[model samples]
Target: MKAFNDFADRVRKEKREHYSKPVSYCLNYILVYIYEPITLNQLANMVNLHPNYLSTLFKKEIGVSFSEYVQKAKKLMKRNNS
Candidate 1:
């Protein structure tokens, strides 16, 4: 029973890590390249996901549309710089 429980925990952790890779990469990329023009297609291609699916997934994971997040990030950066 303990072995089975441990296996289940590991499986759950792996699943979370797998699904988060794209979102995580996207978060880092946007922050690092905040000033660069970023497009869904470009990020989707980099993450090897379909653009439409990535758009949906990104929104689901990040709690905002990609463009909205980028705009917010830009605003925050500008305010910090000023």
Candidate 2:
């Protein structure tokens, strides 16, 4: 039973890590293309998720809406550039 519980815990952790992949990808893409225009739909398509779902997941993971995060990223880029 202990081994079974350990396996289950590991599985849950893996699933969480898997779910974070799309969010991470979006963050990296936004940072890499900070000057270019980006849309939720484009990112959703790139990540193979529905736009709405991605938006919800992104907000849940990052504590901000998709557009807000993008705007923040752009601002950060500008600050760093200067």
lDDT of 2 at 63: 79
Computed on alpha carbons, the lDDT of every model, listed in order, comes to 0.91, 0.90
TM-score of each: 0.76, 0.74
In terms of TM-score, which candidate is strongest?
Answer: 1
Candidate 1 Cα RMSD (Å): 5.3
Candidate number achieving the greatest lDDT relative to the actual structure: 1
Overlapping backbone residue pairs in candidate 1 total 0
- Flag clash pairs in model 2: none
Which regions of candidate 2 deviate over 4 angstroms?
1-19
Local error of candidate 1 at 78, Å? 0.4
Q: Identify the runs in model 1 with alpha carbons over 4 angstroms from their true place.
A: 1-19
Q: Model 1, 1-82: lDDT tens per residue? A: 9999999999988876664889899999999999999988999999999999999998887779999999999999999999
In Å, residue 54's CA in model 1 sits off its true spot by 0.6
For candidate 1, give the lDDT.
0.91
